[model samples]
Target: MPTLQRVPALVASGQLAIPVAEALVALPADVLGRVQAASIDPDLADTAAFSEAYGFPVEGGANCIVVAGRRGEDVRYAACIVLAHTRLDVNRVVKKLLDVRKASFAPKDEAVALTGMEYGGITPIGLPSSWPVYADARVQDAPEVVIGAGLRGAKLFLPGAVLAGLPHVQVVEGLATPTPDA
Candidate 1:
């Protein structure tokens, strides 16, 4: 993994969204201790650009995508975490998991407005308490991974196991599939 110049995320207030900073503060000491934040150019916040520019393997980056599922008049939202090199199994796994008839990536504006985070920086952390966070099993095996910091100007680094342990996060096997030629 690439070594980043980082500080405890809780203390990197300016680089984090308000809710993200607050969430880090509320984490248990052990979990919080392993979370770190590093500032980056907002333009490089996307996974491909971030990995290439920062010398981190693309596979070591986690992408959090917001999904919306609907059944009749009821709609549910979830955050799905998948490795940068994989594709989330939304049509199968997530649709079944949410117990909805149809499921798809939430509109960018809806996601941003609901999460209170920028479009490219919506991390699983600090999401609404009612939203379940589904993480691919592969994420838990990574020794460390880079994830959004709830802002486009920074990223968070932590052990994958730590991410799996966060409240509301459920590790689901085969939640994502490797992208062809990735």
Candidate 2:
């Protein structure tokens, strides 16, 4: 775990993206209490770098990836959270779930623009209500996990159970596969 000062995410407004801060403020007190925010170097915000620099295990980091599914003229967007050590099964599981012929990572510019968050700091907490959040079942097995704070300069820490219970989040089995060498 990071030794950095942890504060209620709701009050860490300056360290969080505007949408993320607002989202935390809207959560119930009990749910809000379980989430904490810590500041980090923007340069090391990526999972592998942050984990190694801060002494947090890479596996304890959850990555929120924006995905787009296209069917005819309709395009649906979703967020998929998977452990840093694993690979999201975007081509199979996500494609099937979205009921689309093709599903893939959203373009960086589009993701950042749509989420109002930095490219490397797109967290699921502040995503649009219409977007489904697919969280890998394995995430709930961890006591706690670190995720982007919607800003590269900070990160959020919360109980895995809390994450699974978040609004619009669906715990999906086999949403991800372990990386070959991870």
Candidate 3:
């Protein structure tokens, strides 16, 4: 396993492996400057695999999911943050939030393309300016959590409060629920 490094050190190395690294440089110390990152094998970016391999507690990580919905000819997108052990309330909540008759997870290609992040690494930070990021209440309750660094090879660690405070972020009540089968 690769060592966890401070964001500044990663930036100083000039070998930043993720697109979000460049963006993170501009964040205030209260945010990105305090983030910790660890390099991981891209193949294990998925939550279960990454947690088992890296010894990260599953609940200590958050997953960001992209949902797309359409109303008439206007299409909208939003990123939802939930704990890995929970399920996003996509059909009901997301659809209602988007004010569309239907909403669904965007296809893999669309998510990666629009977010400018890899499929397994989409994050609320640095998402398109117009997109809104919604966090489940439970996510904001975490002391610190791991999230994608916009590259499958890296994971970002930061205070959950910092994440809840990102621009264009909304903390929604009950945005997620324990997975039905969990």
lDDT of 3: 0.80
TM-score of 3: 0.90
Q: Tell me the TM-score of model 1.
A: 0.97
User: Higher TM-score: candidate 2 or 3?
Assistant: 2
For candidate 1, lDDT tens digit of each residue in 1-182? 33468998877978899889888888999999999999988989999999988998899999999999999999999999999999999999999999999999999999999999998999999999999999999999999999998999899999999998897799999999999988
CA lDDT, every prediction? Answer: 0.93, 0.92, 0.80
TM-score of candidate 2 against the unseen true structure: 0.97
Clashes of each: 0, 0, 0
Best by lDDT: 1
- Please state the error at residue 130 of candidate 2 in Å: 0.7
Candidate 3: misplaced stretches above 4 Å? Answer: 1-19
Lowest summed lDDT across 10 adjacent residues in model 2 is found at 1-10
lDDT of 2 by residue, 137-176 (tens): 9898878999999999999999888998897799999999
Superposition error at 104 for model 1 (Å) = 0.4
lDDT of 3 by residue, 72-176 (tens): 888899999998999999988888888998789999999988877888888777788788889998887888888887888777887788888776789998899
Candidate 3, pairs of clashing residues: none
